[model samples]
Target chain A: MSHSRLGRRTLMLAGAASLLTAKSGLTVPARAQGLQPTTSMRGGANNYRPGAPIVDRIGGGGFLMHGTVRRAGDGAPLEGVRIQIWAHTTEGRERDARSHGATLTNADGVFELEMPQIVPAFGQPHGHLAYDSGAFETVFLRPVMDSARDASLAAHFVLQPA
Target chain B: MTLKHLRAVIAWGGLATLIMIPIAVAANSEYLQYRGPIYIAAGFAGIVALAVLLVQPLLAAGLLPRLPIQLGRVVHRWSGLVLLLAIAAHVVGLWITSPPDMIDALTFRAPTLFSVFGVVGMWALLAAALLAAIRKKRWLRPQVWRFSHVFAASAIVAASVSHAMLIEGTMGALSKAALCAAVLCALIWTVWQVKPWRGVRRRQNSRR
Candidate 1:
């Protein structure tokens, strides 16, 4: 191909790319942009508060559930909040109170709980959690880990006041 | 087995390995727990669709040893149909899992950027299919059809690769990246071999 032909094609490609990028930018909503904090995800909040009493660990400890508790909008970390967690583990199913536990967030809003490795039941390995402190609007999160072999899963809460 | 059969086996086996490895890598994903059967089926359909991309270019270029070009073309056509069904299942299954999310993705209101590229790819694939289906109508001349098909194919690859790369979901990062890279290479090689651009310019010159 001639140099001018190649150069023109390159210029045309560059022009098309810029146009597409500009068009994509226009698709974002005006007021709110990106993945905003929602009330709850679909399939979330199922079987919340099934009479599981507070415990430190759910069976033999091998995996962890950890995240920060932050207030909505301004993202202020809230301390001393109780987060309830459950999963179908080698020890028990999510329905079993023995598979449930709760932990309080530290002063930095960080919370971590040791739990047995979640065993996949219905679909894949996952842990369910709820912010049960009543200070914030109840948010039930069912977080799935990236890998079954991973020892940790994170479910952060950005809460709205009740 | 004869050398001919061995080459055929090697060729087909290599392609199948490329297709199957990514699915195996993604099987370890924990997100599969919450997904329903339909959703899982849908996920597989999409994964397979991506994998089958390797075959299309090979078939189009007549690069697959022991496969006749005529047979390869027929397989290419059927695979295109399968791709359409897989994509439909993927969308419908996701819709069943979460209607609002699927609707957002379909309508371009989805909050995540991945949905945008995915939606773009879906439409491009659909357009390419439509173009292929009407290739007999002669609405577009052969050169025009070839150019448009190549354009649409490129769009589909670009969009799907972007969509796959953005989502931090089931796929293993390295395997997914490798698959995406291999797809790009196959497509580039096929297009280079076919030299569809040269045909278009030559046809225009002949017409003048």
Candidate 2:
């Protein structure tokens, strides 16, 4: 067999082996269990809006993504550049936990802000750690379902070199 | 790759896909599909990787001597490789699926203990793999490399178990907790069985 074909065959066999080895009884145990719905969302209603720029200080053991956005070529901090942030929960359920926003770079093109939590308003508990203070903080960023701009570009602030 | 190597690779790859597929399919079926599958896959992959780390050293030192040493070595090395792949899949798949969560987990902004543990476990596993890959370099003494390997692997297992325990979703609270306990027990067993520290103690005592 060709190397690629051999590789595919090997992957298949490994899958079979793992299936055979897995605790055979978990299928029923897995399916019988149901999703624990969160009531905290207040009737599928979301209060958070998308596309508002925010800069959170996140000093008290909280969610802070502190960084400086600089020009890619010159390595100079891109002052006053805007940075936006937004995120959704794992379940695709948009709620208050994924609040989105944007903030301008400070004099150094450096911005410090607490990232909002992405946990559902009524779902599995989420955590935010303050990278600034080294303590875990519990807070929720409102969830986002749809937005006009790229979330990555929203979160990252980069300066174009002159 | 040799026939044997090919077989091993196939088996590992197939198994990972099989385990992951149903969950992905199930997610599409349900309203909260993506959430359930991603969390479960991440948790399961971490647990399995922990199991590999917990089980291997004992098999290498204890069972290997009793059985065929070469066979034991093969299992250890291959499974270790599989564990690395599983972790890679867990992170890469998740990254592709959700860039925000990946950033959150990597940056330690995940909401639950599970995410924290998962991230930390990933780092530990990475460190251990790095040591293993570079063990033969002149700068790294064999003894130092061995100690670092054991320490990093142990950290990975512990963090993974913590992660498994902390997640809540389709796996059900009880089953998820049980998996975590089982993983912890396996970790403890491996540590006790290998007793890598015992050798250090013996050497020190002998000198005394």
Candidate 3:
């Protein structure tokens, strides 16, 4: 096959392959078109507390959920933003009022809240958080713990200005 | 090119296809970066094994173009051994990565739906591999061996595909599904053509 001919053939084959897969279905990219750079992940919004209060730290045996909150447009850090957090912990399930709490982002857009050590609920160790306040569009997160033994999980959020 | 060379090229292409799927995942997947090296290897081993399976049934039924059925059988046996080893590496690597999780997986205590299917596939593969090792045993009739191996093959493919599908991992969903579908198609086609259920009748026909 000549260089141009071979290239055309390859392109056609690639197109066919993509069309076949696209018709079959796309799992990750199908929902990606509608999402912000940092948005609520699937299952992230589950078990969110609509108005959980900001506290110094939740009942703590020491697992901290912390991350930076950035603005979606310019990536600027947003301060005083409330990030509500909860998890299935030794103390209680994620739905339990004691297991849920909120923390405010500081000047640098970093927020951290100490809570009871998260245990695997339904065989998955995960924590849920939501940016429930009016400052930004609501974003919820369910970050799986690296391991049940790990003492912390970091969940960063980029908020779109409402 | 001569027909013989063309056949050889096609045969090698099958192997290349098997290797490329895992390479694509390892090189491009965002999830793999977060994983430890051992865990990554385990994940790749599973991917590689699944890819290899695409060519397996083709070889067994002598459908791969240009290769003789006898040589294909030989390659099939060797590939079977590779499949066994790859699966072993995958399980062992995972165990080293997390003993508690592996235990949960093995004991069916894992909450994740994938673990049960994985366990089933792994055990089925073990059973299939064992059948080959005991091929010469007097108690093991050839007919029985063939039936059991065929049964095990389908179980392995079904469970392994389910396990792979359930995982949200390094493998691209489209490519992963394509590879899996190819493997299933190859297996079903081979089983249908081979028709192990006709064992005695087919053998008797050949005797004449």
Evaluating just chain A, the predictions reach TM-scores of 0.74, 0.35, 0.78
Better of 1 and 3 by TM-score: 1
Order of quality (lDDT): 3, 1, 2
Over B5-113, each residue of candidate 1 has an lDDT whose tens digit, in order, gives: 9999987887777777789977866656645577677777778878877677778668789888899889999988988998898888777755655776788765567
lDDT of 2 by residue, B86-191 (tens): 8987787666545565676788765445678888988898898787778767465555566677789789878876765555433444444544564466557666
Ranking 2 against 3 by TM-score, winner: 3
- Per-prediction fnat: 0.00, 0.14, 0.00
lDDT for each residue of candidate 2 in A1-162, tens digit (9 for 90 to 100):
545656877899989877876757444453443322111211111223344445452112134444556554346655655444433433233323344444556887666555433343112433221111112111122222222121211123233322
Question: Candidate 2 DockQ category?
Answer: incorrect
Chain B TM-score for the candidates in order: 0.90, 0.67, 0.87
For all candidates, what are the clash counts?
3, 33, 0
| Candidate 2: segments with Cα more than 4 A from true spot | A1-162, B1-54, B64-67, B138-142, B198-208
| lDDT for position B178 in model 3 | 76
Q: What is the C-alpha RMSD of each candidate to the true structure, in Å?
A: 10.2, 23.4, 15.8
Question: Which is the leading candidate under TM-score?
Answer: 1
Cα deviation of B125, candidate 2, in Å: 0.5
Clashing pairs in 3: none
Better of 2 and 3 by lDDT: 3
